[model samples]
Target: MSTRPLRVVVVGGGIGGLCLAQGLHAAGIDVAVFERDTAPDARLQGYRLNIEPVGSRALHDCLPAHLWHILVATAGDPGPGMGVFTERIRLLMREDAPPAGRDPSEQTHAVSRVTLRRLLLAGLDDVVHFGEEFTGYRQNADGTVTALFADGTSATGDLLVGADGANSRVRRQLLPHARRSPVPGVGIGGKLRLGDGAAWLPEELVSTKNMFLPKHDFLFTAVFRRRETNAATVERVGDQLRAAGLDPDLLVQDAKDDDYVMWAYVAHRRALPADLPADLPDVPAGGRGRRLRELVAARLTDWHPGLRELIARTPADTIERFDFATAERVKPWPTTNVTVLGDAIHSMPPVGGLGGNAALYDADALRRALIAVGRGEHDLLPAVAAYERAMLNNGFAAVRAATMYLRLATLPSRTVRTVARTFFRLCGVLPPLRRAIFSD
Candidate 1:
């Protein structure tokens, strides 16, 4: 290895990438993050979040104590367990929020994705290079790696981490055989302002992670109420960053209008908006909200009246669209200076609340492993090999579980539905069963 201090080049500044950068700095290692977004507030992000345990723990591990507190301080209390319902709002069962098996101080039950990212970017203004799109990377002769960029600028480091989201260019270049196949259908989703849907929505829908399993499709809905408004969060987090020797004004986050209900409707490609192409890569710009709402309104004609209205009344611009895809068990490969993490290597649908959490888990796990190398406790290559084994095993397992959970809603078997309904009903009265099922 070169005599230079260890450095990590993280491509993509999403949850995983930024968190890893924070952890690396906390560990006294040198790191840099590159993101394509022109600035932090350039892209609008979904407001709701359902952070799982593995993810929450990772956030605690990777972020500093004050930063972690910023996440908790601005979030609402964790509500009761999520509820399951029939198409007409029939209560099937409710699975209470899992018990905090670990110390409560280490847990972050819930926080908006937007705010979580803002906190992740703390104290990294100088480390994270925005608007610099990553193209590819080449392994250096001295065992370092050099990351190429769209603008022809380059960043070389002892290691390269691909934390880019679902369509990671790093993964494409590093593992050519590892490809993401689209799920059979697409996900049509949007947000309904609290004022618009709360009055008509059932308490079960308002309070829990709501689910609707119709004859052949699924509808997932949940409320996202910010304890502090976006404006307040921005100012508070900005001050917190300033106190931590970071400049927040350089890439301040934009405030949102209001808290709302987030919902996703999963169906075949036929449910795609009439005006949009089926093979479109992502949610198109400008007319997306109106187009997705049209598709959802048509599909929910037979749903509950409240749900129908919720779908019908959701603002066009607030509506979101996405295609479905899942990452399978990543085939094993030789360890190198370059590796992958988060959605770049393993991604699943929004169901089961695993995607973001899994990414956080990857950040913490890799952070600790690399920290060991920085501390001279192990060699870089060996440390990475161990990290990849744990990461791939857990990451792929989470993907499989998330995809399976989503598939449960799409299964056409009447028998399967009946069994699931029975299980939910059974959990209602059985304390032991409730503990077993919701303890994750």
Candidate 2:
């Protein structure tokens, strides 16, 4: 170790980046985050997040205790169970949350994406820099790295991290061969405000997330009920954070205006129209949303009327359309003082709740490796290499798993679809199989 303490520069202040900052700050390490967004709520896509065991562990390990309390306090009610249903709302199989495990980290948290972003940004006022565009990075003769910005400014540190999202500029400089390929599917998601709720909705729809299998696609829906409204939850949590002398105003916007029923419709590429504008990459989300809504609304006529109404009822602006893309596995590269994490390194199709969770895992894993270096257990460069190796293994595995789940959901094979339906039918009967496959 040198006489100077280790310092890290993180680009993109997303969940993964902030989580790493939190962990390093807690461990008494020097770190700074450069973010392009003007503020925490600059991009408020009020989508709900199902933080599984892995993600739960990451947040718990990274966030300060008081903020963690806020996390628990604000988390929506867990789905607790999942029910696989046919296109017409007939239950085929069900899987409950895993039986209590020895690992206390085996808990689940359902919160809004916006809410979690705010939760992660707590107490990092001095550490996080906003509106800083990271153009690229450079290595010095002394082995330190410097990140350049759009304003002709730069920040140098012992190590630089690219926690930026899918279109990471860092990855481009490091591994030009690595590419993010669009997964062969299209999806649209929305949150439906449940004012007094829909009368035709069944108890199963409210109690658990339901996967509806149409002829050649999947419709996943879940009910979200935060203990309080988004404003109230933030106000209550904000009060506690202020009392603790923290950044009370960090969480600016409501996670959602009210409790809602969330839904996502995914279609197999094989079923897509040859001239489908749905796959056009340049269209804005609102336009793509209108196109996707027409397509989904047509396909979902065979599903429950209540579900149809819910999708139709989703406000136009709140409708979101995104193409699934997975980043190519990062091949073995020479280790330096620079590295990448999260969607910056491994972008996955949206499935299995793995994308964000896997990124959180990356932050924690990298934090642990740095912790080892801080303790003099490993040399800095070698420690970063070892962490990269493990990160690639775990992160790409998550990408593959998420991709496989997406394929299974949207596979157009008649025989495969039959097998899938039959398998779900069996899961309805076989207790051990149900426990094995859907352990979550």
Candidate 3:
């Protein structure tokens, strides 16, 4: 342990944590990442995200030059014919809805969760410890923090960050009183190498870029594709596929998990005005994607022909359901020095895709705060308080916005849906609103 350098422990190795570690290290600060997983090769899967300027800027600013190239390599190869659609690709308004502007030329690359991790881990000098699940933390009066892990491992650092996802142990131990918001709806998605004739779904629809669909039933389909990789990864992911209620046998081959391109669709039953019950549950329970498909079939699809067509093409096994939960912002995130970042702090619905971006932003901001405090220029407590003030304000706003977007896509009324499409269109051309909507 180098007493000359500050010791920092980041509990989660997700986007935010990885970015934070990279940023601090680049700034000549010593940091270590303690990920619950044994290696980056194991158990991490999610669709591609639209990395906005906030996260893109942070990633480029924090990581090295080569990392940027890696991102582009993993990006979706959106072909020429890709177009934005409302009721269906052909059913919408006469004036063509332009595609979501993706700058393939930019530094931000659309990448798989694993690739992003690997990129961040580059040149890190192997400080990351795998299988070190966070148990808890304690702060000493001397300004040092002690961390306990599930494997009976303990480490001490100057500061602790909980970058763990929604089920963060650090957050639970620290902010025990904070309320856990149930996902307003269920989401299910999967990836399958498209069989013959399935190529009509444009490569753009499933590639590095994300595609959102509105079927007859209020179901929303989102697709993400990643290039192929190795076999063990495929096996683990294959096991995941086998566990699904939908027919896994339909998938043509068991390919490498990383290489196997896939799509994910999420639907909200509780989002429906009729399905929403009076009392909302405190903690979200649904994690299975199959439940979402069932809800979609029952509630959303009778009206749209295209929606039915898309659903008909989907193999039952591809759908994996999860609840889009958020944690209500409360006081003090830790009992001692432990604090949460990213989804652990504010787990918003993925509608805005702002969850990861917001977290990395927190990493940048919090690292600055810590640096300021360490230099004796500012008080640590107040510095953290100021950070939380910004975090809560922005986090709450994002949650509200994300939920609204998901609600609209899942069950858009004629007028509201029309306005949404128009607003998204205008967002491209309108400078001020674009700044407001897309600004940090």
Which prediction has the highest TM-score against the true structure? 2
- Could you tell me the lDDT of residue 312 within candidate 2? 77
Give me the displacement of residue 434 in model 1, in angstroms. 3.7
| Per-residue C-alpha lDDT of model 2 across residues 40-140, encoded as one tens digit per residue | 67866756778888888888888887877787777776576778888778878988666765353567777777667776776788999998999989899
Q: What alpha-carbon RMSD in Å does predicted model 2 have with respect to the real structure? A: 2.9
**Candidate 1 clashes between residue pairs 3 or more apart in a chain or in different chains:** 289-316
- Candidate numbers, best lDDT first, in rank order: 2, 1, 3
lDDT of 1 by residue, 365-389 (tens): 8999888888777889988999999
lDDT score at residue 92, model 3, on the 0-100 scale: 26
How many clashes show up per model?
A: 1, 0, 19
TM-score of each: 0.88, 0.91, 0.72
Query: 156-248, model 3: which lDDT tens digit per residue?
Result: 887788889888888787777866677556555555444565566644344333344344223333344433333333443444433332122
For candidate 3, the lDDT comes to 0.60
